[model samples]
Structures are given as C-alpha cells and as structure tokens.
Target: MRSAPDDDRPGRVIPFGKGRDRAYDAYGHAYDADEARGDHGAERRVDHLTRFMDFLRRRVAGDYEVDEFGFDPELTDKVTLELMRPLYRTWFRVETLGAGDVPAESGALIVANHSGTLPLDALMLQVAMHDEVGRPLRLLGADLVYQLPVLNHLARKTGHTLACREDADRLLRKGEAVGVFPEGFKGVGKPFSERYRLQRFGRGGFVASAIRAGVPIVPCAIVGAEEIYPKIGDLPVLARILGLPYLPITPLFPWFGPLGLIPLPSKWMIEFGEPIRTDDYDPGAADDPMLVFNLTDHVREIMQQMLNELRLRRGHAFPPLF
Candidate 1:
C-alpha cells in the first residue's frame, strides 16, 4: 500500500490492518523512502508465474516426460496440481491425517469410501498423497470415468487407469501406489440420506487384485465429502439415455443450471489407516473366495470405523473455511 508520500521512513512499516498488524516483507529487495513498500507475496506470485511460463516452454518443446499409461508426472505435479491445490487447501479446507501409515517404498492398495456427487474426493486424495506423502497415487477408475469426453484424456494423464482387476494387479506389481473405490457408482449415486454408508465390496475383486500383487491394502476414510453435493434425487431415465451412471439432482443443480455445478464448500477430512498386509498370504491366495471375502470385510470395517471417528471430530458439515 502506498501511504503518505511525505512520510520518509525507509523500510519502516506502519502497522494498520483489520485482520493482522501491517508489515512489509521483501525477499531481500531494496526499498526507497518515497516508494511504496513491496510485498513478498507479490514477488512470490511473480516467481510462480515465471515457473509456469518455463513449464509451458518445456511442454511446447516436447521436453516433458510421459509413461506408457499416458501418465505425465511433470504435468500432474506442475500443472494439474495448480487446479486441485486451491480446492484442497482453501475451498474445502481439507485435513489429511495418517498419511505416514502409507508405505513409502513399497506398493500399497489404498481403498477408500467414495462420496461427493462428483468424484472430487478422489481428486482431493490425489492431492493429499502428493503433497503430504510425496507419492504419486494412481487411481483405479471405473469405465465411466474414461468414457467422459475431456475427463478421459485428463484422467489417463493423471495416472488414473480403468478399475479393472488386470490394471490394478499390473500397477501394484509394478510397485505403484494404486487407489480403488470398490463401491463404484453405488457409493457416489446413493442418496444424501445414505451418505457415508458402504454399499458393497462387489465380490472382493479389489482384494483379489491386492492378493495377486502381494501388496498391502491401506484402508482410507474420508469425511466431509458427503456434504459437498448432497444428492437429493436422481434422473435414472435421463442417465440411461445419456449412457451415464445417474443424473444427480443436488440442492443447487439443474434448477440453477451451470451455477449448480459449483460444489458446496464443505470441509473435508482424509485419514489413511494402517496397512492390512495381503503379503501375509501367498499370491495365489486371491483365488480363494473365502480369504478374499474376509479381507474385504476387514478393510470395509476399518474404513467405516475411521469415518465414524472422523465425523465425530468434524462436528458440523459446513464448518467455516477459515
């Protein structure tokens, strides 16, 4: 802020603010007595812009790296993260815990309960793992995820593959941190009243994949996603016509048109539980239905328990973002 031009105090800050005491922080930048005090935040913002420009230069020069699955770590870490970080940090005010429980050097199957009208929980989880655990979490998405027009390409680039047993097994065996939401559409499409409820584990396919790959299954519980976009009703006929899972009718959507697409800024919590070792059993143990069923139930129980605990701590659905 430019104050009185006559005030001739070089680098001397006059404290005046409603929220915080006024102060000027310069990144070792010089200041003149008559000139306006420079803000470090502004300088840092310019630095961010410069880095982004360099990233664009790299992309334009075809100098970025991409894996066989079309996964671009450079784009995800540098570009896609810019889109997700704000929501994870500001809008939703997401709190991630137990990230240390995730095995750092080994492949692990991260199984989490899915909610939120859209698959925003998944995106937030991706950001949380990247920021907190310093790992690129690969998500096992459903067929519908890849069927969407623009999302299809973006998902692949973000390291999200189809939620097929084969893909899950392959990614895990390759020592990648893979995430799976076993409830699929049932978890996301369920009514708001049924929020946080686990639908079903579906023949324990995810467990089988984990067993085959001999990876630890880490149960993750996420709270606050239930309130992001409360699903009051569904348009089944329209969904079928569009070849979509379900046409969600939230409190704001359809009635409000594009404005309805805005997700409610509910607080979010993510907790990664201790790993349930599938390596304890032989790789062929996946073939045994009973073993897979038991492990699936165990994981589901742990996730539910964690969710219940997190909700207790969260209190209200829409806490103040600040």
Candidate 2:
C-alpha cells in the first residue's frame, strides 16, 4: 500500500491476444518496482491480466517462474510501509495499546477482529507498524482476495499471502510477522445487525500456527471500520449473478445510488492488544479442543471489550472524515 511516485499513472487497456480470455501489459515489473519503492497507484489492469494469462498459459504449458510468489523482503518493506501512507492519514487515527509486546525478532501470529467492510483495518494496522513502530506486518489474506485480478497482484506485492498453516509456518519460521483474522469471511460478512459483535472463531488455526512456530499470539482489536460501510442489507440473487460475494446496501451505495460504495469518510481508531504467549503451551496443545476453544473465546472476549472501550472513548458512533 505504498505511495505512488508522480510518474506512476494508470495505464491503458489492451485487447486479449487472439482467443485468450484476458489481455496483458507490462505491469508486473512496475508492480515489483513500485513495491520496492513503496509506491501505490491504480493498478495497470492490462499488466495484471497479461501476467496472469502468461502465468496460466506457462503453468499449463509447463514453464513458469520457479519462484513465482516467493516473498521479497526488501520490496515488501517498501510497499507496506511507504506506499500506504496516504490511506493511513486519510482514514485512520491509529493507536497501539501494547506494541511493546511485539518481539524484535522472529515471527508472531497477530490474531485480530475483522471489521471494516473492505479490510481497511488490516491496511491501517500495516501502516501503523511500518510508519510508527518501524516494523512491517504481513496479513494472512483470504482466498477470495486472490481471486480478483488487480487485487491479487496488489496483495502479493504488499506481502499478503494465503492464510493457512503451511504458509503461516513458512513465513513465521522465516522470521516474518503474520496477521490472521480468525473470524475469516464469516466475520466480515456478519450482518450490519451484528456490527462489532465478533463472530465465532474457528478452533485455533492461528494459535496452533503460533505454537508450532513458537511465537506469541498478539491479540489485536480494530474499531471504527464497522461503521465505514454500514451494510444494512444484501441482494443475494443479484450478488450471485454478478459474481460478487455480497452486495451491501450501505447508506451511501444503494441508498445514494452511485455513491454507495463510496465510504462516507469516517475517522477510524485501531488498537493493538497485548501478546499472549503460546510458546509455553506444549506442541501437542494445538489439538486439545478445550485449549483451542479457551484461546478462541479469550480472543473474542478481549476484542469485544476493546471495541466497547474504544466506542466509549471515542464518544460517537461515527465521525466525519473531513
């Protein structure tokens, strides 16, 4: 999410090469370079389509970059910390409650409540760590995100990979910080009726990942995102037809027509809670249903308490962004 240089402008579209379902452009090089420079811009759509198509064809034809999605430490640092500065300034007024608990070295599982209709909480947290605390946090993005054309490129460029034990263990074992929303898509899809009320977390995927890697679990709470795009209702049939996961009727969107997806600019607050040491648990503890349940319950409870406290401290349900 790094800032784009003045020279970086959105590119033109190109037709898909003969019979191909998608087109292509030279976008990945810029993407990688921008990430290295922490630059953000409207993705060169053609570039992504081209690269993806090439990747697909090559993979099917048995030739591709052997290390296609491998992590580039330096580039990731630039992208997450630098490019995303504008977003951090405009949307979130973030505060970390227990940044001190994050260790200087090694990987940790940052278990956080998923709010903000569009995953802005995670973006804000990444900027907070990179800009304020001087560390870069990699998010464990959902599989759905990777399905989008340009979004998938951005996610990979910004250091987000899939959320799974193998990826988590590999990254953690390599000494990189990983963020996970235990609530997954369910938390994000929770009705506006249940805003800020945490959904059920699966039994300890995050906790187990941490224990196996011997890292602490940092409980994080994000407030203000729930109200950003207050989803009041959904159109399931249309959503399915359009291939969109959910079609939200926000105050701005369906109510305001073209303006619906335009999030009413609201001041946001994000807080990072204390780290719970999972390293102390026996390696086999991940399988103990009772243990996972207790940990999941504890995280949910802490997030709820933090949400309430943040709501009270802020003293308003929503604040004007401008």
Candidate 3:
C-alpha cells in the first residue's frame, strides 16, 4: 500500500504499465503518512496485474461489458488512483487542512466559496478529494459547463454532473461525496472588490439538499483563487454578444491580449472545516428561514476565518496581477 502524505507537499509522477499513458502518484494521501510500496502493496499489485490480464483476455474473447463497475478487478482502486497523479500535479500546489475529518464511507456535502472565476477551483478541489483524500467527489457543475465542447466531455470524465437536487440526493444516498459552490456564477464573477467575501447562498438549496439526504456539510475555504484572473471590469454587451455570462477584463489577456489567461503562481490554501451535521435536523427545517440563515451564516463565517488565517499564513497577499 503506497501511503499518501498527510500534508500538502510536492508530488512527482511514475509511469504505469507499458504504453499505458497512465501515471502513479508519488505523493501520499491527505491523512495517510505511512509510505507503503506503490500499487497498494506488492501482493495487491500482482493481483491487479493478473486480473487486468484476465480482463484483457476476456475482452479479446468477447465475454465482458466495459460499463459494469469492477469489470476489471485487476485494476484495483489503487491503480485507478495512480492514473490521476499527473493531473493534480499540473494544476495545484495545494495546502490542505482538516482532511482527517473526512469520513471513510459517509456522504458529505462539500460547500465551497467558488473563486478562480473560471471554475478551476472546482476541478482542483475534485482532484484533491480523489487523489489526496483517496476518494472521488462528484461535483455539481453549472449548466453553462455542459454547453462547451471539450469542457463538457472532461467534466463528465471527471465525475461532474449538472447542479440538480435529484442528482445530489441520489449520490448522497449512495454514500458518495458531492461538491457544490452555492455562489454559482454570481460568486465566481464577483468583482475584485468583493474578493474573499462570499455571496449569499440562495434559498438554502444546499441546506435543503443536505437535510433531505441526511448528510453532513463540509465547509471548504480556498485562498489564492481570486488572483487567478482578477475581474477589473465586465463588458456586459460583449459578454451578451459572445453568449458568455460575463466578459472579464483582467490585467492581462483581454486587456493585454491572450497572455492574460495565464494564471499567476499564487500559493493556494484549501482547508476543510469540521462537518456540520444535518442528520439530526428535522426534515421540515429546510423551510425555516431562521435555520437556513443560521446555517449559511455559520458556513460563511468559517470561510472568512479561513481566508483571514490563510492571509496571515501566507504572510502577505501575492500582488493580485491576473
């Protein structure tokens, strides 16, 4: 069993089977500091390898269905995880906290303040959940995401679904991790003046979803995302013409042309606060404005605290240059 690190440290990649194009994560899991041999340990590796060969043989013999879960028993959960190593490394230099609080097999609603203005924070969070926390988190993406060509395909492959309550309920019922940004596009597109200040969590859909599903809510706070592409202004007419939600005018890119899209190397801090249990709440509590308001206020407070703490932790904010 290859152990992942408890803290967010740098990671490297190692190749898997020949011509596989897959990679193994040298970095350990979020809570696991015990470094074990990769491939989930030697015996497990052999088992998976054998199973994979058997799977291939069966495929060649036309005796299998690829869609079935665990169809390739040889490719254990460990192997599947290894394939994601490279993706995490390229996107984030994450600093994690409260990872040990995550339950091994319980459903969770990960509520985060959406920043990065581009939804990259969501993808980074998903990668962190899967590779660092050792589990896949189903993301609730916006409807606009599915409208794009490649983005839509990648989102599905990465286990994202349309932001719908039914989908959330179904996943939680199955003990799966689900992530949602209550701010939605409004939060992401907020001006630079509003950086780190969370928008209102509308009608408490997340609260309702959690209460209905009887799951705990995990408040996630992310710093350094706001600097990714600081929106100095919005060209609403151009945005409408382009069919975009907002026409962002960052310091670079549109202002300075295409070069603006490159995100500055701002160190990232992502902390998961202790879970707020809704399991004990009355199912009808969703309609109570007091309940929704309190919950939203509570989560917002935690996120703000994290932002303040991370600002101190980082010593100084990196000059916000998009």
Candidate 4:
C-alpha cells in the first residue's frame, strides 16, 4: 500500500540538499561555515596561543629532548621554523618547484648552489622542505660554523653538523634528508657579476657520502639569492680580522649601518630535481673516484640548467609590493 508513502520506510532516501537532512547539511558540512567566518579566526588565535604556552611550559620543565646530533626538534619546529616562515612567505616570497621529487620517507642527499650574503638561502631551503614535504633537511656546515660560540650553538640546535663524510653518512643512513652546499664559501662569496655561475664542487665529497649511504642525490637550484645582498665587493682585511670568509660590501651594507643589513625584497625560486639513484650501483662502487666525480658533475650541471631556466621564469628580481 502507499499508506505512508515511504517517508517511514526502511532505509529511506533523504535526497541530498541543505534542507534534506534532519540533523545537518549533508553536502556542505556539519555546521554552516559561511555563517561563522570570524569565529574561525578567533579559534586559530586561541590555538596559536595555546601552543605557545605549551612550548614555554616544556622549556621551563626541561622536558625537551634532542637527537644524537644535538638537534632540538622541538625548538626547531616550534620556534626556528615559525620565525622563518614570514621571511620565506612575505619578504622573499619564495616559490618552490618540483618539491614532490624529494623522497617522502626514504633517505636522500640534496645538492644545491649556495648564495646570499649570510647563508639565508640555507635557512629558506630548510623551511621550504619542512613546510612543503614535511621533512627536515639536515645541513652540513664548515668547521668555522662550529668555532664561533653563538653560531655554533644555533647550528647544532637547528640540526646542522660538520660537513664531514662521517656525519653526512650517518644522517643519510638514518633515513633523514641531508643537504650540502658543495661550493662552500666560493659560491656564496662570489662577486655580483658572477651570480648564478657555479663554482667547482670541492672534491665531490657529497657524492661519495651519498654513494656510501646508498641514497639518491637530489639536485636543487636556488635563484634570486645572488641579488639579495649583491656581493658588490669584499673587505679581505676586515674579513680576516673577523675570522669570516668574506666581509661582503653590498651597496647599502657597512655604509647605512644596521639599515644596510636589510636584504632587498627580491623574488626567490627553489627547484628540486629528480633524484639520481645510488642504490643501483654495484658493490664497492662508492670507492670509485671516477664514478663519484662523474655523478658530482652531473648534479652540478643539472642544478645550473635549472637555475638558468628558473631565472627566465622569474624575470626581474623585484616585483610590485602590492
């Protein structure tokens, strides 16, 4: 019979629509999102504050832990990365490409050109990797980085270690993302005229480390760092006195005092290329100097090509602020 028309029938269909559900909207959400726009913002603020408070509590109670490399993941994630996000997002407006090429959970070595006056590029790269792919890029630093008191402390806490084969191998074997700037100070301290020109990758140490760890090597290209502080000149005497690689003399820096230290708001682009697999190599291939050297050169060439392409895409350094 058509007695109750199927309204009370078993498993009755509700026909999708806002007013169709007796409880809440089935198409949109359990609650009307449009009706509470301001509420979301307020909730976010509350959540942020709560997290900050929790961080402070951990610091006070000494409840934080560090890895074997003295990497304080808590501080790096809660404080360091959060602080760098604004610079990566607004100031430099860094745009990342091919980030998905990075291995999701496996070990990999990232080889990239280094630039920018003070290694800001490294920090930006680290932030980008962590934010985009949810992985930490452990940077290998030179000896000088660990000699200075303040910089040494910060470096260790932020997961940086001596740029040695031992450390790199250890990190890679642990399934962690390792990053190396093979050019050292050469690429970062080069003159403005030589911008985007890669320097000789020292001895291919990074390649050997990757091979030993049986990890893929991902070549990365970073553009726009060259113009940030524009290494117009260098003060060798001052650099020697300060124990710095080079005392960069940008147009504004050391002239305008602290104001000169401000980096120009240049557009930045980072590209991660496909990983070159090392696991396929035969036994003991890591000890072969020629293979390591060849791989190193290949990575460098790919990075340079990527830089050239990215430069064309970025056009000029600065864009309209608005």
Candidate 5:
C-alpha cells in the first residue's frame, strides 16, 4: 500500500483529487485540509472587520466633524452611505445625466418628483450627489421623519432636517446644496395607477425658499422609482392608528410579512436640468404670490417634460436598459 500523503503539503494528493487537494491546502497554516478551505471565507470576514474597526477609531479620535444638525460626514460617508452604495450601483444601477448642471460651489436648490412608498429615492439621490456630484446634499424632510425615534437620529446624521423655510434658508445661506420634494406625501403614497403623475407642489414654499436665498433651482427628474413597490391600495384606518400617512398595500407586503417588503430591482435614471437663476428677481419676489406660483409651475413643467423624455428612453421600468 502507498504511504498516506502529507495533508499539509501544497500539492499533496487526497482521495478527493488534485484540484480538491489544492483548494483544501490553499491556506498554508491549517494542518487539516478541510479546515484550510473553510478558513478562506473567515479570512475575508476578518479583513472587513479590521477595516471597520479602523474607521470607527478615526471617528472616535475626532477625525470627523458633526454639524449642528448632527450631520456626521465621516460616519455617513464611510458607514451609512457605503451600505447604500451597493443598492445604488448594482441593484438600481443608477445612471446620472447632466451632472455638470449642478453648481459645484454655489448654493442651489434641487427640486425633484418623489415616489416609492419609502423615501428610497431621497437616499439614492444623496448617494448620487456624494459620489457623482462630489457634494453633500442637505435634504429637507417632513415632520414624520423627525418624529420617528431611530430614523430621526439617522436622518439627522445623514444631514436631513425638518422641511421648514428656516432650515432650508440656513443651509442655502451657508452655500450648501439643498434638496426638496415639493409634492410631499401626495406623491409618495399615491396608487400605482397614478404613478409618474406629478402632484400639486405644496403652496410653492420651495420656490419661495429658493428665491429668498438667491439660489438657482435645479429641476431633477428620476425615472424607475415609481415601480419599486407598486402601491396597489392603502389602509387609511391603520395608517391613522399608526400615525403614518397611509398603510401602503403593495403586492407582497401585508400578506407575505417582512419578506415581501423587498423592493423590486428597477433601472433608475436621474437627470438634472439647466439651473433656473433666481438672482435676477427682486428680493421680494419670494413674497409675491403670483411670482412664486409661476416659478413653481415652471420648475414643475421642466421636471414633467424631463420625466416624459426619460420614460421614453428607458422603455420599461423593469428590465432596465444599461
């Protein structure tokens, strides 16, 4: 009988075969061939853990700054935004157009249509600005966002505050990019049948805010978010009880439990239109009702037109074109 081959040898033959032996001995330290192959995955996990520890150390050592609103740039960039990047890149496969239209240095307002039962669109836009435009977007969110416990904390750390004129003006005056979804709950909770139909922007408040701050309004149109979780219906009573706008009824949700909440992978395209300057208008233009309405309508029209064009380019929301 042939002597048993040494299991620790790199090229040692085993009963399984030469290929199996090589794989089993790939990590040299392990005495058992079976254990060596299993260590590969553990090794990768160790590497990830090590990097994460380093990141935390930097944050804890005052290498990062947190703004008054609790916006921690380092944590948001390294941890929170990093977690969302895979979804933005691989799942949604977001394609950006007219990124240059966004002002690199000056303060500006980003006005966009909002949809998707969850405010995933907002998070994705945040990723886009950070990764593509190379700027941190300060988003103005609704009261509901700040009312939730854990969510409120994360939202602030990610640079979102209550959607009030005061907050918007403050951010803009500081030369920070501000984003607002004028449609509010009306656009987000609409039925699937009404998808992509722009809702009435609330009182042109965003327009007034932009005018007062003397910043340009950049119309942003996003396609593919409408289909994420098709809102077939809603339960108003439950929503009221839960203090939510509406209890969304998607195909899988409320029926399949938590597993159904997974969003369908949709191809996303975000385009920024040419900036509409507010500098020419008088300072009082913000207070003028008619002026605010006209400018609001103008931004809405531009977004709608862009939506139509993007929809035409992307044929189907699912099976999105690369």
Candidate 6:
C-alpha cells in the first residue's frame, strides 16, 4: 500500500481522512478549519450594496432631472432598470439584431409586437435600447397601465406615457425615441396558438403620428415573449368583473399558485429593422386614410417577415438561440 499523502495543501484542511475520525474539541465539537476564512460572495454583496445605497442617496438629494411626463432618468437608471437588468441579461438572455439601425440622434418610432402576459417585453425593450443602443426609449402605454395607482407612478417614472397621438407626437417632437405596441391587449391577450401572428395595426394611428412628426418608423420584432406565458385560455366573465380586457390562463398559471407567476426562462431576441422614413411623405399625407393604411400595412409586413426570420434563427423557444 502507498504511504498516506501529505495534507499540506494551500487551503484549510478538513479533519476526516482515509481511516481517521473527525478531529474534535474537548466539548465534542468537530473542528472546522475553514470557519474563519472570508467569503468572497459576501464581500461582493457588500460592495454592490454600498454602490446601490450611494445611488439612492443621489436620487434622494434630487440630483436627477424629471421630464414633464414625470420621467426620472436617474431613478430609472439607478433603481427601476437596475432591478430588470438581471432578468433581461441573465434570465431571458436577450439578443439584439440591427440595434445599430436605430437612429443615433434624431427621433424615430419603434413599433414591436406585444405579448408575455405581463408586459415584461416592454421593460426588456427599454433596457435593451438603453444598454445596447445607448438611448432611452420613451414607451407609449395603454390607459389601463395608468389606471393602476402604483403601476402608473412607476410607469411614468420609467418614461412610459399614454399611447395616444398627442403623447407620441409630443415625444417625437422633443427628439425622444418612442416605442409603441399597436396590437395593445389584442396581441397580449391572444391565445398561444396565435403566437407570432401580426394583429390589426389599429387604424394606422401610429403611422399617422410618425408621419406628422416627420420621423422614421423602425419596425421591431421581438421573439420568445410569446412563449413566456403561453396563454391557453381566458376568463372573460372574471375579466369583465375585474375591468380587465381578458383574464389570461397560462398552462402553469392559476394552477401552481404564486410559483406559476414566474415567467419561463426563454431566450429572447429583439431585432430592429431598417427605418421607414416618413420625412419623404408630405406632412399633410397623414390626413389621408389610404396613405396611413398603406404605410401601416407595409410596416406590419416588414415586422412579420422579421419575426419569421428570427423564429427560424431561434429554432426553439425554450432552449433559446444561444
């Protein structure tokens, strides 16, 4: 038999050996050699906590600007968005295509498909544009978003406002990039079978807004959000009672209780297509129904095509496109 190996390694030594019992103290407590060692993980957490507290102090001191719509860039960047960063980067593993296509300076309209049951896609897009494109995207939200007291306050702080032509035009005129989901509740509340299908673009109002603002329209196709929730059914009666558009019933939701509320860890892709310049069209062209309709149809077609291409690239929703 070979001689017993030396226990002289760099780190603390464990007591147990080939045949020896654990080393114990007089009180019968086994000696733990590593107990006094520092934990790197704890050290890292303390560093992060220190940074976050500093950020909060700056915010509380009013060291940030707030826009007319109640957008607080400092608070959003330091707090609200920081909370979503892990989800966007780690959980969803969001990948962006054509992010460079987004105009670096001038205003533009970003129109994307909406799903994911909880509007988490919008939050992800906000993070993506801010992180990858180096620009803050002002989102156009539904009235329902503003009706909820706490959510409304948070939405405004995160740079989201009512999705109407007035707000859209205002933001664009101010040289702010605006994001809109024309599908609204229709796309978000649709069944899983209808996933990736482009719904009606809602009378081309967004196109008209873009035209009036003389900004380019950038069609965005977001994949993976549809599978996150996977709406299998709806409870219209309960929805009516609750004043919601539709009560979504996902496969895991309402069955697994609170645990089911967590979204599936699906890979996400957000691709921005080339901009469609509305500057080429006369401003008065916005008043033309046919013109708006044609532009809307064109945008819808472009987004749909991009979605299909991204889907092919993705290959699967669960494993994601790594």
Off by over 4 Å in 4: 1-51, 320-322
Candidate 4, position 295, lDDT? 86
**Native-referenced Cα lDDT, model 2:** 0.66
Candidate with better TM-score, 2 vs 3 = 3
TM-score, every prediction: 0.84, 0.73, 0.74, 0.85, 0.83, 0.83
Model 2 lDDT per residue over 27-133, tens place: 22322444433433335444455555644454365432222344443334433444666666764555555666676567777887887566777787776665454
Checking candidate 5 for backbone clashes, the offending pairs are none
**Best TM-score among the predictions, by candidate number:** 4
Span of ten consecutive residues with least summed lDDT in model 6? 11-20
lDDT by residue for model 4 (90-142), tens: 99999998888999889999999999877999999998887776677799998
Worst 10 residues of 1 by lDDT: 12-21
lDDT of each: 0.80, 0.66, 0.68, 0.81, 0.82, 0.82
Query: Global CA lDDT of candidate 4, please?
Result: 0.81
User: In model 6, where do residues sit more than 4 Å from their true spots?
Assistant: 1-54, 320-322
TM-score attained by model 5: 0.83
- 1-322 per-residue lDDT for model 6 (tens digits): 1112222322211221111134332211243435314565575455446645544554566554577999876667656766898999999999988988999879999999998788889999998887778678899999999999899989998888998888999999998899999999988788999999988888789999999999999999999899889999889899999999998889898899998899999989999999999999899999999999999999999999999999889877877243
Residue pairs of candidate 2 with colliding backbone atoms: 1-83, 1-84, 2-83, 2-84, 3-40, 3-83, 4-40, 24-50, 252-260, 253-260
**Candidate number that wins on lDDT, 2 or 6:** 6
Tens digits of per-residue lDDT, candidate 5, 112-156, equal: 999998889999998888767767889999999998899998999
Tens digit of lDDT per residue, candidate 1, span 73-138? Answer: 767765686689899999999998998899986899999999988989999999888777767889
